[model samples]
Target: MAATAAGAFRRTPIERSDQRVAWDRTDQAFFAAGACHILAWVCRESYSDKTIEIVAVRLPGQPQVFHTYAAWDGWAFDHSGWNPEPQLLAVNADFEGQPLERLKITEGLAEFCQKHHHRTPDQYWHDPRPRARDYIGRYIPPWA
Candidate 1:
């Protein structure tokens, strides 16, 4: 089990190399998935300052999407001061009928971050909004 700053511990299965890139290059969009997974792990482990309220997704080829929500009760993060209901982080992409593949990528990214440090090189580790933006701008667009 891995330890987190909020005292939350969880175990994740390691991924194989083939499962890492199962999506087609043209229609596969794992940017948001990767971001959310990494952000969740980071928030749970290193920085428990601001709670991740919600993660909403609107994919291009999927009928039903996925959403994740978290709340702060003084032990972790409290973004309620900025917004009464807590702001959500939305991820728009096209899974291309490869939901399972997308999930693998997300999990892989989180595990990779947990084992390796990708956020340390970043200057804005404390801020999620900026870090998300930078990630999309720098990595997501290029991958797409």
Candidate 2:
């Protein structure tokens, strides 16, 4: 994930060609039956010195249908856990309902950070562990 200022993050919608874009956890539940878009982002929390990753799905033809998962441990989907903060979770739940042309990722991220700052950060960091290396290995050649 790219490094950035506090509360800054990157949003990427898994493309049709990306192998990983195929049906995954976000597609299992009834909430995502018509999901056509899967998006993810990575951000840093300066206040807690932690890194956070979020993955979300949008159901086509359903503007209000949104499901998201958050992970403070690492970038892998399995490591992600549901955000317990209702107010912040609501931001994600209602995100796709807004006008995409007018919605700014940065603005939405800032709002999320503002609402969830009160919670304690996750204690484990994956950056230094085997899971982190294994994930990177997916794209990096052994010789690299």
Candidate 3:
């Protein structure tokens, strides 16, 4: 299901995100891979009823952030689809032996949000908007 949804995405051109992201590669199958912080913010605002929070992680000794996503109800959602949070964390932490620290509330995500997300912050400093929200439905499964 996640893969199917990912298939539907037309990858956003990542020029702006280059200044914000730290991930070594953005050629992953998930369209949001390059702009995870932006897409995650979109998902969080679009599904406010789910009480989703944006989250991110860093390499063990590196300050640079990576792999942003939305979390709620012990589950996590990204362009790839939804998965149990623990499983997702485990996979994200050690994918291809690129281990990372535990997920953290997206405190470090503000700069990305500020630059790319152009929505009313609600309470956030620079939450993103409509286009991201519009893109979200394609990834939401019925059970979710």
Whole-model lDDT per candidate:
0.28, 0.28, 0.55
Off by over 4 Å in 1: 1-17, 22-30, 58-63, 66-144
Q: Backbone clashes in each candidate structure, one number apiece?
A: 0, 0, 0
Which pairs clash in the backbone of model 1? none
lDDT, model 3: 0.55
**Winner by lDDT:** 3
| Predicted candidate 3 versus true structure: per-residue lDDT over 1-144, tens digit per residue | 422222233333663344223233342333354455666776776666767887776678875555677777877777566777777777665552666675556454556545434223343223334434655666654354
Ranking by TM-score: 3, 1, 2
Off by over 4 Å in 2: 1-47, 71-144
Candidate 2 lDDT for residue 4:
15
Candidate 1 residue lDDT tens string, 28-136: 1222222333343433343345443332233445533342222233221111111222222211112133221112123343344443333321322233444433332
TM-score of candidate 3 to 2 decimals: 0.60
lDDT for residue 47 in candidate 2, whole number 0-100: 12
When summed lDDT is taken over every stretch of 10 residues in candidate 2, the lowest stretch is: 2-11
